[model samples]
Target: MAVTILGMDIGGTNLRSGFVNDRFELSEFRISSSQAICGEKAPENIAAYIERLMAETGIRPDAISIGFPSTLDKARKRLLSTPNLEGLDDMNMVERLENALHIPVYIDRDVNLLFLCDCHANHLTADVIIGCYVGTGFGNVIAIGGEILVGKNGVAAELGHIPVRGLTLDCPCGNVGCVEMIASGKALKTLQETWYPEEAIGTLFTLHASDEPVRGFINDLALPIATEINILDPDEIILGGGVLQMDGFPKGALEDAIRLHARKPYPEQALRFHYSGEKQENGVIGAAILAFRHMKREKGQPV
Candidate 1:
């Protein structure tokens, strides 16, 4: 019998959920405000919402997989922090949700799930791939031999929090000097608010692509990619986020900045880039794929 999996993508702004079909497509898709689904960021509220969704859609799942915009613990059982969304920090979601739903729940970093989905969408065959997604926060994920790289502490590919030498901007991660402070959509929004309050948020890149501050933003965005390329020399790299998808954003300038900062001759020249999709269901689809892999493993099959 085919396995039934419920997949969810929990972000700062929205909660996307659906079931994955054989074609790697989403079925019975639904979207709701993150606050609505995880009211007050409570685990119990999240459990209740899932119950409501199942009741409304009449799609009882055999298993559940979720991608969260937060750091997962070594066991993938709880979120260590949700800098963008409050009250979810250090919460044991897997145990709680499983208890409520009476089914297995698998969880992972949102970027890891996104990386999984993007690779499948792009038909990538690389042995190593690194993904950097710059949305409300800077998210990084690495896969080697089809496995997500979780370090000793399960926080391995935390490229976003890698500190800048002299930056001291406060990060919601309870840390100062984090790279996300300067390289994410949050960074661009900060720039827009402080320096160009008259300009609209979506048009910051469109209107100020050449301004010194925006230029600095571009360079800051490239820092992690260049640094990763030099270190990992990954088979492929993916760069995506709300910032990159914005109209009039200088994709070329960002690429150029990456190349300039990356070491010459080898890693820089070998760079292969893949852009992540903008579909509404991409993250949920990714979560579904993640569930599929876990189901395979549970069935004593290879992933």
Candidate 2:
């Protein structure tokens, strides 16, 4: 019988969970508010949610995988920090969930899971892939030989937090000058409210994409991406997230800005860029895939 995995994606605002088979088919999808399920006690709430899911679906998963929007330990066993979700820092999430469910539980940065799913769905065969997602905040992940590149500190590829000159707004990460403060969906909303107060946030790009302020915003968004391309010389760069999927998002303009900042000579000319549209269920589906891969690796089987 093919392995069935339970996957959960815990975001700052929403919670999504589902069951996926080894073949990557998803079912029993559910969505809820993150705060409603767990106002401050996220780990406990997640455990309870898993219990509820299993009861409702009547499926016993071989393993469980959760994607977290936070920094985790190098072992991917504990959350070190969750800037957006309170009371999640330093929690032993893996152990708690495993004990509750009597099955293996795997956890990793949410962006890493997204990258994995995109690679599988798109059939990307690159040796090295970089994923940059611009959503409520900026999310980034790097994969080498199909494995996420977790650095010694387990915080590698945090492209969004990279400091940029002249961007001094305070970020949720407690850092000033971070690119995310000026270039993410949150930033776009701020810009829209400030200059184009009459326009809806969703329509800013559509209505004023040609305006200088809007163009500058796009450049700010592309700078960190180009910087990563120059350093990694990745085989492929996949860009996605809510911001990229916004109405009338200037995809071509963003691409042009990236090429402008990317290193001259070879990488810029050879770089491959793939723009992925947002999928409501991708986070949960990717979590399931991670669970399957983790189980296979543990059993000395190919993933």
C-alpha displacement of 65 in model 2, angstroms?
0.7
RMSD of 2: 1.2
**lDDT for each candidate structure:** 0.87, 0.87
1-303, model 2: which lDDT tens digit per residue? 888888888887888888998788889988898776655766677888888888887998988988888999889999998888777888888997788778889999888778888887888968889999998999999888877889998989889999888767899998898989987988898898899998889888888999998999999998899988988999999999988998899999999999999988769899788877478788888898788777779889988
What TM-score does candidate 1 reach?
Answer: 0.96
lDDT for 276 in candidate 1 is 90
lDDT at position 173, candidate 2? 91
Over 4 Å off, model 1: 39-41
TM-score of 2: 0.97
TM-scores for all predictions: 0.96, 0.97
Itemize residue pairs with steric clashes in candidate 1: none
Query: What is candidate 1's lDDT per residue for 98-130, written digit by digit as tens?
Result: 888898899998888888889998998688899
Q: Candidate 2's error at 254, in angstroms? A: 0.4
